[model samples]
Target: MTKLTSLTIAEARAKLRAKEFSALELTDAYISSIEKSRTLNAYVVETPELARARARASDAKLAKGEGGALEGIPLGIKDLFATKGVHTQACSHILDKFQPTYESTVTANLFDAGAVMLGKLNMDEFAMGSSNETSYYGPVANPWRRKNSNATLVPGGSSGGSAAAVAAHICAGATATDTGGSIRQPAALTGTVGIKPTYGRCSRWGIVAFASSLDQAGPIARDVRDAAIMLKAMASVDPKDTTSVDRPVPDYEAVLGKSIKGLRVGIPKEYRPEGLSSEIDALWNRGAQWLKEQGAEIVEISLPHTKYALPAYYIVAPAEASSNLARYDGVRYGLRVPGDDLIDTYERTRAAGFGREVQRRVLIGTYVLSAGYYDAYYVKAQKVRTLIKRDFDEAWNKVDVVLTPATPSAAFAPGEITDPVEMYLNDVFTVTVNMAGLPGIAVPAGFSEQGLPLGLQLIGKPFDEETLFQTAFAIEQAAGKFTAPQWW
Candidate 1:
């Protein structure tokens, strides 16, 4: 029998339905694996009992012929999603003791589909860092490393834990959010398939806000098919979230293994900038070549305004974050610090609660949105953002899907980037898709010389995840699933 850790969601569901393995047994296997792989630091909180209870319920449902596609499969929830009766801190001190009274729409939807919840996973504080180091719980270690080397590698953030847990077989798949590369970057680092569906594809109502305009919920799994299953279950239109699209959700799994012949894949010249690594450049070329072998028409195109994407994203995301985080005033929902006066209470609480990076972003955000500087910073950045979206609009006119490197380079060591601006630049290749509210995905293409994973991103037309997944599935089949790190 294949261990629970190695089986895909579809395989597990079939076996489970046939009474080959109980949901409790599967959950136990993953819990045991998590215990054995302590060094990965993937989870911030483990809810084994809760998971077992949910699994038992699923098993009962299965007995009654009431099971869904994901029924009884263990799934990891990124700490960013609000879970009712569970602590959701966003891996930050500011909301340390915060427990939500209501479940996030995403989490509720997963449960509604019969997926068992394993636990809340770790992440960079407030989804701000490139590496997982900025997390209050400490950095998550990459499972891959050279023999006899004590060097700690990065599990990319802020969805690092989600990717790490799935890669380590702690869960069959995980729910992840990408506000400027959180899901895709970590998926690349941990060598898993992750997708950021079109902006409104998944409801964001219960997810903890980071960059509201850019944040999107998706899935990270071992294969494209598993990702599709989990994504379909999680996607629903919620009236609570104004941004959630009310359009009909597609059957993502139904179209898997479909042919990609005659599809137009655009290769943006501007993505291969001067400073990108030769190894990455080579892998990108190899990926494009592989698509050609599969009969995809690769055409070179220009997204000329791409150069301004990073700067504009920084301005827009932080501005939104500052406004979102202002609700944590130590009064209503989160931590509370007693003070001498009303103003003192707010100042002292925020200063003492938030991490340095979070504080830095808050300050920058406040400054940009301030009365005197709004026109010069915020307004100008929005215009640039519009131009960046226009660039994509022009490209999509001629192509069905756009292909590019997910990150400038593979995962770096923990704490490699001390400068905040440099850290922000890590999302250069990713943030634009979020800005345009388009769908994107990161699938493992190959590995670097040091054996770290490299990923290729596919940006699709608005709400056109079918094309994105088809393109990604083709690439994933060509690349082959990566072997798990031995240390895991």
Candidate 2:
């Protein structure tokens, strides 16, 4: 018999509907896999009982042929999402043991589709780090390691645990968010598929905010087809979230295997920065050639404002984070440290609750939003953001979609990057999509010399994720699937 935990969501869904195995059996396989893979620290909490109950309920629905699209699929929810009566702390000390009374719109959508919860996954505290080291729960080790080396690598972040869990086969898929490069970067590092849909494509009402304007929920999955399937079930408009778009969610999976003949694929010159890894550059070239062979018209384009995207993203995201996080004062539901007085209590509580990375970002956000610096930093960054968007708007006139290397290099060992600025550069290739409020997907395309996975990113026009899914399928088909050696 095939290892139940090794099946992709698409395979599992079909087999589940065919009654080859009950949902309870599938859920048990994952629960057992997760228990044995704890060395990766992918899951901060495991809800086996909850998952079993949901799975049994799904089996009942399936027996009557009345279940939803995700009918029996088990998924990991990023800690940043609110799961009612479950741990939803965003992996931060500040939000210690906090469980929301309400469910995030994305997770609710998944559950409504009959997906089972596998518990909250770890992440960078407040979704504030390029690597997962900033999480109060500690870093998630990437399932992929270097060739012939046992040193553990980071799975990228702030969606590290989501990516790790999927790559490790502990979940069929995972709900992840992208503020800058949270979802894509981690997916790239871990040899999984992730998409950061266009801003406002999904509701954010129950998600713990990092940078409200930049954060968007999507899915991390074993492959592009699985990602499309999960995203369809995850996206929906909600009255509770004013930012949620009123547009209809399309069937993304339907577009897979579609031909891309004459489709204009843009290659941005600015993306080929100096000192790019040779292996990554070679794979990127091969990706274009693969698309071109399939009749995609490769066009060289320029997004001049992309050079400023990283700095602008840092400024804009942190500024929003500081304002959004202000509500976490000691008086609220989270952790509180009593002090001499109310003000002292607020100060002490924050000082104690926030992790170092969160504190640094909050301070940076506060400083940039301060009266004297707001105009210089925040306003200027906003202007740069507009230019970045304009750059994409211009590119759309000449191309159907844009392609770039997902990361500068492959996954690195934790603690290899110490300088904050150096760490920020990990997102240089991905932050522009968030700045432009566009949809982007990362597909595993190749491997590094060290034998770690590498990925390519596809950026699409707003609300044109169908094109992204179709094109990513092309890449996936050509490059073939990558699987980490099962060391856990």
Please list the residue runs of candidate 2 whose C-alpha ends up more than 4 Å from where it truly belongs after superposition.
none
Best by lDDT: 2
Instruction: Please write out the lDDT profile of model 2 over residues 311-380, one tens digit for every residue.
Output: 9988999889999999989786889999999999999999999988788888999999998999999999
Q: Which ten residues in a row have the lowest lDDT in candidate 1?
A: 143-152
Worst 10 residues of 2 by lDDT: 325-334
lDDT of 1 at 315: 84
Pick by TM-score: which candidate is best? 2
Tens digits of lDDT, candidate 1, 126-164: 888878888889889877664456687888888989988
Question: lDDT of all predictions, in order shown?
Answer: 0.88, 0.94
